[model samples]
Target: MTGSFGATSTTDEVLAGVDLSGKRILVTGVSAGLGVETARVLAAHGAQVVGAARDLAKAKGATEEVRAQAKNGGGLELVELDLASLKSVRACADALVAAGKPFDIVIANAGVMATPFGKTADGFETQFGTNHLGHFVLVNRIASLMKPGSRLVNLSSSGHRFSDVDLEDPNFDHTPYAEFIAYGRSKTANVLFAVEFDRRHKARGVRATAVHPGGIQTELGRYMTPEVLQGLVDSINANQPAGAQFSWKTIPQGAATSVWAGVVAEADLVGAHFCEDCHVAEIVEGVDIRAGVRSYALDPERAKALWAKSEAMVGERF
Candidate 1:
């Protein structure tokens, strides 16, 4: 399936010649960027998409194109989900469960990037809580809605290379707080969550995988100052081979990997692994290049430990 796709593939290109007619998908963060693009392409290809966002009015406006382009049996529905608040997360999951509609694919796509240190409504560090624990509880709470043969696509990032989950001080009570470090920990948690979730549910045919959307100029970078953004670009350029400077992907290209992993890529190839550029990423370590996944992100034991820690932090067991 990935034979012809790469970093530059767009979402529409990935699903070309494919029919999604009766498939129902749930995508979070549909109010902007890749989430909107992902939902639009899938619905345009004939899949019913349920979009979740913290702001309904914003999402309603953002997804107008999705509704306008929906075809065949495809359609769009809106739901409210504020991942920073456990209360909101649980409420969203409960409402979905009560609705009793099964999802063929669930894309945990909403997230925050580097932000000043803060805590969630539930008192977890903002990045970890919003990016990881919020989706953790919501996904687990709604896991029953995902049937056999279903798949879960978690939107992780190469930023995961920044740090692993700091289980001992997740909230940074004793450690210094750094925005990118927190973002990295949460991203790593995203991958590990997929690892453990796939382990526990693959037998039931529910597969989960994580993907990096590559560098895209999205609202996800709203928090970064020009200097911060420039610093990152400089770092990438410094690490690149001569004349091969880093570049940003278009929104369609950024979203390709998510939809590819969710629908186009073979389940066996993507399940429980981290992917980028529409293919399973190789595990590279002991270097600082802005490609591939880190070994720690795919470690099973670390994934299990993070799972248990997540359950405890969320006060819910799966």
Candidate 2:
């Protein structure tokens, strides 16, 4: 089934009658925005939700909000996770494993966008390190703790259209570090990660998907300079003609697709697809279009190579 919702669809609307009692969901970056909304809706639906954030205080606040929204209340728990560090990722997974309960869905929603050029604690580029490699290790570390039929959702972006993975200089070693290109590479890796992940784990009943949550105005862009933000505003306005005041998605609306992918029963519809607006996206090409996964993002060989490189970097293998 090709289930389709729109950019305007809210989380509650998409999950209207779905019952998730007894299900367990792990959501990363649940401190605010779409991630918080996602945790709220899932917990409200009776899922045992774990809200993972880098800051314990933020996680506590977000969990309280989710609990207040939950019908049964206290269905949410908080965990500390800093995806920029592989050691932290492993530690978080260890804590979850210590809990001895398998996660039914793992949502890799936390990410850094176009931040200033920098290195992660492990010396990898910031965007690539946190957005892709960090999640890469986290998922693999926790893979054994995932029950059969569990789902993994990686939040990619339309920004992926700007560039593909730069295998030669993923860390910007020899090339100048352009923020947008770095972000694009990371987002592209998000898609490719899901592709390779599904290939490896689908037969074992663990499925993976990548999502482009459209252009929601969120804290993800907090690192952008005023000029950069204004340029983005101008570009959106010029292309959309709909008053370009970040007229893309509300947080709840943006979280709808991720929620759907987590709960939707149709396995065929969920895995290895680049989703947008709650449906499988149509393939796109060239510079002018605004739909579908770019071919490079889904290249299987590239995905495998990325997976191998990631395992080496993280010092772990799935």
Candidate 3:
């Protein structure tokens, strides 16, 4: 089914007939998993892909397979980026800016899952800090590097169905912390980011879209313990409709939507929607292990509010 593409698409299948010569793309977290795969297919199609990760050495080692996939002048290079820290985000943005090349597509793919309650370098919750705020700052700083018709793809998750952002206590200062909730809130922030980003920049020719790349098992879940994994399984099982099948995606299957969003002209043109598989997801009324985007995630007012709060937190305006 994934081979046939469409709602069940894989990375290469969508790019199979496309040409990306002269295109420049950026993918975060390319050290492994979906990020590597997303880069691989794009490069294979003849795009120049710059992959950013925290550990350049690890990324260099992990992207070997990705390099092997390059064809048609598609090439991959590693850049140092650690989204958990604001300083690192700035440095990476600075490096990219100095390179003086605007990206045609930006995939904010690197992220963390539910972990033991902890804070990032700037004292924000681990999941919220890295998954949302970090990307928020980086994208803002790098906005100037996106020319008109640029595509910005943020890797959101079906987990956004799990909860909405708690604006008052995103950092867990005023409210009690729950790892899963933190993850959900961060994912929600991802969708909201696209909403506001596209709203703000679409007129300038930059388009932004968010994708829930399905439930693929990846390094994004490294922090989930056996107990946590089982709990996730149980929660999913309980919430899903009767007889709904549970399927974990292969890496290729997981990256289909992000790649599709980046290269497909129609998708880039119709931006600011959260997608699953390779199509715009329907607005779901309530969460029950369904695959549609949440109302709160797409709420315009909430998106604006989150954008303002993010600017305030990051101490910079885009």
Candidate 4:
């Protein structure tokens, strides 16, 4: 399974000949890019997909193609969700829980990156609140909906290499604010969430994993200027082996790994691990080439610490 796919593999290619009939998937952030593509491919493969977005109108418009292309009894539905707001997260999770429909997979795919320092509606740092804590509450609230054998895929990023979670000053009140540092902390939280979640649920046959979708020119980078992006690429390239250069992946290729780990790959291969390029990632340290998961991101102790801090921040325990 690992050799069959790589950085260039597209979602359609990874899922070719795979039938997802009777499966129900929940994907957040369907208004654009990877979320839309991931929902489309899953629906096209005969899975019923419930897509969540901050703007339902935008999501409905963006997902028209997903509905049209659905086959073999597959379909798509939309729900309103604003990950930055815990009220909305709880409401969305409550609605799903009330409906009593079990989900085969839950994809925590919505996130923000490198934004000017700000706070979420709940008064926490924006990146940490929205990217990590938002999904943290949402996923944990509805976790019971995922039966044994189900999977949870958190959309983390290579940006995690920048830093690990700062449990003591997660809101940046005592620390100086830096955009990518906050983004890195949030992404690392994403991985730790998956690691701890997998540990908590795996005995029941439910597993969770995080993925880096590769560098893509998506709305996720809307906050970063062209100069900044080029500088980043240059930095990554500078750290690569001789003659190797950094390149962006298309949205399809970017999303391939999420769907691959969610369904196509064996549960044992991906459970509780960080994944990239459609396979489980190696825990490499002291490198800056934009490949491999950072060892700190997968630390069980760090994961547990984050979980406890998240509960305190969100005022709810899973």
Question: Number of clashing residue pairs in every model?
Answer: 0, 0, 1, 0
The TM-scores of all predictions, comma-separated, are: 0.98, 0.94, 0.95, 0.98
Pairs that collide in candidate 1 are none
Cα lDDT, all candidates? 0.95, 0.85, 0.87, 0.94
Q: After superposition, how far is residue 303 of candidate 4 from its true place, in Å?
A: 0.5
TM-score for candidate 2, residues paired by index: 0.94
Which stretches in model 4 have alpha-carbon errors above 4 Å? 1-3
Q: What is candidate 3's lDDT per residue for 48-101, written digit by digit as tens?
A: 999999999999998997789788888998899999999999999998999889
Which predicted model would earn the best lDDT? 1
Q: Per-residue lDDT of 235-286 in model 2, one digit per residue for the tens?
A: 6555543433455688989999898777873666868879888888778875
For 1-318, candidate 4 gives per-residue lDDT tens digits of 544899999999999989999999999999999999999999999999999999999999999999998999899999999999999999999999999999999999999999999999999899999999999999999999999999999999999999889988998999999999999999999999999999999999999999999999999999999999999998999899876677899999999999999998888889889999998899888548588999999999989999999999999988
By descending lDDT, how would the candidates be arranged? 1, 4, 3, 2
RMSD of each: 0.9, 2.1, 2.1, 0.9
Candidate 3 lands at a TM-score of 0.95
Determine which window of 10 residues in candidate 1 has minimal summed lDDT.
283-292
The digit string of per-residue lDDT tens for model 1 on 224-262 reads 998989999998889877876788999999999999999
Better by lDDT, candidate 2 or 1: 1
